[model samples]
Target: MKAKVLVTLKTGVLDPQGKAVQHALSSLGFAGVDDVRQGKLIELDLAETDPAKARDSVEAMCRALLANTVIENYSIDLVD
Candidate 1:
């Protein structure tokens, strides 16, 4: 099984890196972009075969180590 985790900052959290990227985009003339929020995608291979079980396990991984729950939120996708 494969698990994909997307981790992103909460709406009210400060994102200095995202801000820098936004500024750089504007400077590069991508003015249509009004805002930018940066996030990460993590892919993991697992021994579990069930999609539900894989998702559950990856969610726990996010809560325990992949993400700081207080500042970030994560979603898990399972691919077979």
Candidate 2:
């Protein structure tokens, strides 16, 4: 099985790095770039074949290490 995890900051959280990138893009003449939010995508290859089990494992991985749930949220997509 394969899984893709997307981790992103929650809304209303200040994202300084994203803001900096937004500013840089505007300065480079990329007009209408209103806002930017940074996030992480993690791809995992697993040995399990059960979709439910794989999803549980991936969710655990995200909660245990991949994301800081205090300021971030994560979603997992499983693929064969």
Candidate 3:
């Protein structure tokens, strides 16, 4: 099984890196980009075959290590 985890900051959290990127874009003349938010994508290959089990396992990974739940949120996508 293959899985993908997307980790991103909560809406109210401040994102310095995102700000920098936005500024850089404006400097480069990419206009009309009002806001930018940065995030991470994690890809994993697992031996588990069941979709339900894989999703549960990946969700556990997110809670335990993949994300900072206090300031970040994560979503899981499973591909067989």
Superior by lDDT: candidate 2 or candidate 3: 3
Best by lDDT: 3
- Segments of candidate 3 deviating more than 4 angstroms: none
What's the TM-score of each model vs. the native? 0.92, 0.96, 0.97
What tens-digit string does per-residue lDDT give for candidate 3 at 1-80?
A: 99999999999999999999999999999999999999999999999999999999999999999999999999999987
Candidate 2: tens digits of C-alpha lDDT, residues 5-41: 9999999999999999999999999999889999999
For model 1 the local lDDT of residue 16 reads: 90
List model 1 lDDT by residue over 20-67, tens digit each: 999999999888887889999999999989887878888888989999
Clashing pairs in 2: none
Clashes of 2: 0
RMSD for each of the candidates: 1.0, 0.6, 0.6
Q: Flag clash pairs in model 3.
A: none
Which of the two candidates, 1 or 3, achieves a greater TM-score against the reference? 3
Model 2 whole-model lDDT (C-alpha atoms) = 0.95
- Report every candidate's CA lDDT: 0.90, 0.95, 0.97
